[model samples]
Target: MVSTPLPPADEKAVWVRSMFDRIAPRYDRFNDLLSAGVHRRWRARTIDALAPTGGETFLDLCAGTMDLAVAISERAPGARVAAADFSIRMLASGREKAAATPGPVHPVAADALALPFPDAAFDGCTIGFGLRNLADYSQGLAEMQRVLAPGGRLVVLEFTTPPGKVFRALYHGYFHHVLPRAGALVSHDSAAARYLPESVKAFPDVRSLARLLREAGFDRVRYRYLTGGIAALHHGVRP
Candidate 1:
């Protein structure tokens, strides 16, 4: 199979949306298999950072399959979670799960860089394994900040390079080599699968992303590496 480079910045969002739509059918399952179900633990940690209480409104931006939204709903039971994503088919794939969640999970078609809601719309916000896919990380972070209420917490969970050299080398070997092939086999879209590692490679590191959150006007920024630094969970608050 031929390896395709990631789309240029001007065309990224459109290409990403279409790619996700094409892979929506196998996205969840492939994730489960590839990460050996550890992605769930990472997401659980993200929710821990968000610390949702009952009766709050939350936005799960770039929520491809509403995984975080449903998890938050299940955790708080009285929260209303909006699962916003630009890819309609990706959101559609999670409809059943959202419907069955304890709290209401509303799926909305929204661009991360241009969210449709008014300012201060949510009590908390989260983006899990999704923020890196945004065409403009700064703009996306700004939009997330804009919709959050004063003191609203923002939690971001994303793939990152490990700090340990040996672990990093081994992880990169599998991540860049094995995982893409497996993802392509499962999703039946080699380019989309290849985009996964390329996207992660192109994204900022954990500390760099924390600095970005601060630069985007979030206060009290903090981050912690997860699962041997394979991923990171970042927390910040809107002042």
Candidate 2:
């Protein structure tokens, strides 16, 4: 059975920031455990699709703990990465991680709805595990498109429900039950953990999300499902 979307009440950006702040300390650890480290591979694939080379300017939105920021910097030594998140705690944690990385990573506190950058400021933008949390995914997508230079790319990595009947049943059980319990135990934020599954359930899946990207002024929207459609990496280009 398909899950109904959660109430729109919790979709506010302020609500999202508060929830993330409560789990900032253990967020990365929980992600590592929850995805069984497959998140790393997924991120690598997303970055590989972007093909960021030296001298490029990249933006990592909702960049909690700077995982994507550090990875992009390492992958492209000369690349300058600006990682932004609305949550101060998450941004602080990300800054701490960025400081230890060899390449340049700038952690900024910014809102996804109103990115504090000039139009066409970035050569590319990435949002890893962030889209589902946005109050207005379409607005967030538009903001990313606004910041990207013409011909620049945007890569989004987000969780989605699996397609197969048996797999969907198993995955839903894990997501709705096991994940929340495990995440709450690790992150010490029961509400945040509970919100995770609800948020993913509320988000548009691969095909619908790609259509949203196109509506947001991106061209050549495409997506690749991973882990039996549990997650997807979406790519789009600014024309």
Q: For this target, which candidate reaches the highest TM-score against the unseen true structure? A: 1
Candidate 2 lDDT over 105-216, as tens digits, reads 9989899989999999999999999988887888899999999999999999999989889999999999998988888799888778888888888789789999999999
Number of the predicted model whose lDDT against the real structure is largest: 1
Off by over 4 Å in 1: 1-3
Report residue 126 deviation for candidate 1 (angstroms). Answer: 0.2
Window of ten residues with lowest summed lDDT in model 1: 1-10
TM-score of each: 0.98, 0.95
- Residue 101, model 1: lDDT of 96
lDDT of each: 0.92, 0.89
Cα lDDT tens digits, model 1, 93-201, are 9999999998899999988998999999999999998889898999999999999999999999999999999999999989988988998898999888788888888
The clash number for model 1 is 0
Q: Which stretches of candidate 2 lie over 4 Å from their true place?
A: 1-11
Cand. 1 TM to true fold: 0.98
